[model samples]
Target: MPEETPAGTPEGTSTARVGGTVDVGGLALTRVGFGAMQLERLEGDRDAAVALLRRAVELGVNHVDTAQFYGNGFVNEVIRDAFGDDDGVTVVSKVGATPDPGGRIPLRLAQRPEELRAGVEDNLRSLGLDRIPVVNLRRADSGPGLRAEGDQVVGLDDQLAVMTALRDEGKIGAIGLSAVSLETVRRALPVGVVCVQNSYSLVSRQDEELLRLCVEQGIAWVPFFPLGGSFPGLPKVTDTPEVLEAAKSLDVSPAQIGLAWLLHHTPNTILIPGTADPAHLEANVAVGSLRLDAATLRSLDAVESRTGDIVLD
Candidate 1:
C-alpha cells in the first residue's frame, strides 16, 4: 500500500490517494498536472499562453511542468509571472540542456556536471524559487548543435547522481527523467525517481510499459504531447471516431474525452496537455470533471495508432 496521510488534512492536498502521488521530497502531488511547453511564443502571440497558465491554476491544477530549454526561458518566466505568489502550486522544471544564443525550440545538451549545475541555477533564477518542486534531466538526441563537452557522454546514472546530490542539498524537491527509455528508467530507479515524462497519447502508446511500471511503483507518469505532434494527422486520440462519439455522448469536446481517458486509465497517469489559448486551457481543465465509463474507456483502448512507434529515449 502507499504511504498514509496524516489526519485532518484535506484529501487531495497532501495525499492525492485517488490519483497516486509522486513524491517530490516528502511532498505528494496529484497525477493531473499542467505542462507549460505551449506557453512560449510559438506561432506569434504569448498572451494566450499566459492566460492558459493562469487559468490552469484557477481551475485547480497544482502541478506545472516546464524546462529550461522551453522558449529559452520564456515558459518559466510566464509561470513565474503567473503564480509567483501562489504557494499552493508545485512548479517542476528540468535541466541538462540550454537554449542556443539565437533562441531555438529543441535545446542542445550540456551534460557536464558543471553545466548541469549552472542549468539548475539558471532555472532557480528564472522561476524565482529557492527550490523547484521537481527537476528532470531533459535528454534529447537531436536539435541545436550543442554537444556534451567531455570525453564521454553523461549517462543516465551520472545524471541521477547529480540530481540526487542536488536533492539532498534542498535545491530540488524530487528528480525525474524525460524522453528516456524504459531501460534508462529502470537504471535510474535505484537513485530515487519520482516521475517520468514521455510523449504518450491515444495514438502513441509506445510508453505503455513505462506507464505501467510507474503505476506499480507509485510514480507519477506525465504525458507530454497529449494532442499528438504539431501536425495534421489521422484521428489518433482526440480525433478518433470512438472518442468523438464518446465526447458527443458526454456533451464535451474530443480533447476532454481524450484527457478523461488518460485520467481514468490509471491512477498514476497525469495529462499535461498544453495550449496557447485560454479557451483551450479552460477546456483542458474541465476535463478533470469529465469521467469515462468502463465501456468508453475500453472503446478508447481499442483504438489503434497507424503511426510508427514513438521512441523518446
Candidate 2:
C-alpha cells in the first residue's frame, strides 16, 4: 500500500472516476489506470514516452501498471522520474521475463524462484518503491505445453510459491498473472489473486470468459493493448464502423467510445490505453468521462461480437 498523503491532484490537474472503485489487497483502485509500456524506446523517442507518463498522472491516474521486462527497467525509471514521492499513486509491476539488451521485447522466460526474487528487487530499485502494490508474473506463452514435455518448465505453482513468499515477506501487496489463459488464472487463484492482466479489447476478446470471471470474483481486470497492437495496420476497436457511428452520435472520439464500452461492459474492467504523445494521453484520460447510451452500446456490442479474421495472437 502507498503511504498516506493528500487527496487532491497536482496543480491545474483534474480527476474523473471511470467507474466505481474495486479493492485489490485492501487498496481501492480507480477503474481507469495507466499502463507504462509506452514509456520505452521500443517504439522510438524517449521524450514522447516521458511526456505521456507525466500527462497520465497530471490527468489524475493513480494506479500504474508496469513490468520489469518492459524495456528492461526503462519504463519503471520513467515512472520514478515522473512521480517522485507522491503518495497518491500506486505502482503495480510484474516479473518473470527478462528483456534482451539488444532488442525492445523480452527474449524468453527466466522465471525461476531466484530470478523472480531478483526481478522484484530490480523493479523496486528501478521504481524506487519499497513495496509494490501489485506484482504479476508474466508468462512467456499462453497455451498448454508440449505433449511430450516432462517436468513442465515455468510451472504456475512454482511461480505462485515465489509470489506468496514475497507477499508474506511484505515485498509485494498483491499477486497477479499476465499473458496467460483462463486455466492459468484459475490455477493461480489458490495463491490469492488481486488482478489479471491480459491482451483484451474489442478486436481481441479471446479472454472474454476470464474477464467475466474476474468481474464475478471482484478481481481487477487490467487490459493491455486496449487499442489492439502496433500501428500502421493496427486492428483497433475504434476503427470499427459501429464504434465510429457511436462516437459520432455521442459527439466524442472513437477512442473514447471504445473506453466507454469497456467501462460499461464490466465493472471490474480497467482500460490501460498506452500512448507516447502528451496530447493523446490527455485525450485518453478524457475517455473515462464519456458515457455511451444503451442503444449505441447495443450496436457496438453487436458489431464487436462478430468474429473476424483479425486475431491478436
Candidate 3:
C-alpha cells in the first residue's frame, strides 16, 4: 500500500512537483499523470486502491485515465469513492468497449453509435458526475489485436456524431481517441480532438508519424503502453539493454527512464503509467524529474523500435 498523504493540490503539488505541464482541453495538467486501471486489478482491496489514488492526487497528479468498462465500471466507482468530484485531477475515460468476463481478452467492442452514447452515460453514472471532462472514443481501428466486425464496425463520423452531441449537451467536456491511425485522426480533426492515446514507448516507435501529426495539430499525445505490455512476443522497455544501462547510470529504475524518454521525445506528450504498488505509483509520477542527457538520449534513440504484438489501443 502507498504511504498516505494529505489532500491538497494546486498549491501543494505545483509548488514542489517535477511533473511538467500540458494542456488537456485548456486544463494545464501534469505531463506525467496516473492511470487508474491497476485499481481494477485490486478487486478485493478497495481501500488500498482508493488510498493509492488519493496519494496520487496528493503527489500532484491532476490527469487520470480510466474507463467505465474497466472492472465493468468498478474502476470509476473506485475513482468516485477516492476523489468524490475532486477537480484537481482531470478524469479522462474511454468508450468503444466493455468488459467480457471469461472471454479471450476480457473486453469486447461496443462500437455502435448508440453503444457509444450508452458508454458515456455509463461513465457519468459510474463516476457520480454529470460532466466527464475528457472522453476518448476508443475506436476499434488500428488494432494491436481487437477488431470490429458485423454490426460492431461503426464509422468514424457515426461515433463522433454522438460524441459531439454528448459534448454539446455537457455530458463530456472534450474528446480523445485511441487505437487510431493517422488518417483516422485526420478525419476526426474537424470535431476538435483534444488528445490521442496510442501504444507508444522507447522500444515501440511505430506511431512516430502519428505523434508528429498530433504535435503539428496541437493535440495532446497520451501514450498508454509507455513501458510496453506483458503480452507474449511483445517488447518491454525495462528489458532493453540500453534502458537498463541508463537506469544504472542515473540511479533510477529502467521503467523510469523509459517514461522520462517519452516526456522528452515529444511536446504535448502525457504519460498515464499505472501501478498497484505504493512505491511504483510514486515512481511513476516522479518520471517527470528524471532527465536524459544527450549521450543517454542518443543511445536510446539508436535502439531499434519494436511495435511487437502489444495492443495498440
On TM-score, the candidate that comes out on top is 3
Q: How many backbone clashes does candidate 3 have?
A: 0
lDDT of 3 by residue, 1-313 (tens): 1111234534235323445677778887678788888787798999998899888887778778999988888899988988865457679999999888877678999999999999999999999988999999998677465788899988898899999999999999999999999999999999999999987888888888888889888899998878876566688999999999999999999989998898878868988889899999888777766668999999999989876755433
Give the better candidate number (2 or 3) by TM-score: 3
True-structure lDDT of candidate 3? 0.84
RMSD of 3: 4.8
Give TM-scores for every candidate, taking all chains together and pairing residue i with residue i: 0.81, 0.83, 0.92
Off by over 4 Å in 2: 1-13, 17-20, 42-52, 101-107, 141-152, 230-234, 304-313
Error of 2 at 138 (Å): 0.7
96-190 in candidate 1: lDDT tens per residue? 77676553335566776677788899899888889987898876532112344553287766777778888889999888887777888888888
Clashing pairs in 1: none
Candidates ranked, most accurate by lDDT first? 3, 2, 1
Ranking by TM-score: 3, 2, 1
How well is each residue in 1-313 modelled by candidate 2, as lDDT tens digits?
2122235533233445434356777887766778777667533665666666666666767778888778777888877877767547788898876776553333456667788899999999998889998898877544221121323266778878889999999999899887778888888777889888776677667778888788777778877766564323446787788888887887888888877787777777777776666777777777666667788878877764423333323
| lDDT, each prediction | 0.70, 0.72, 0.84
Among all candidates shown, the one with the greatest lDDT: 3
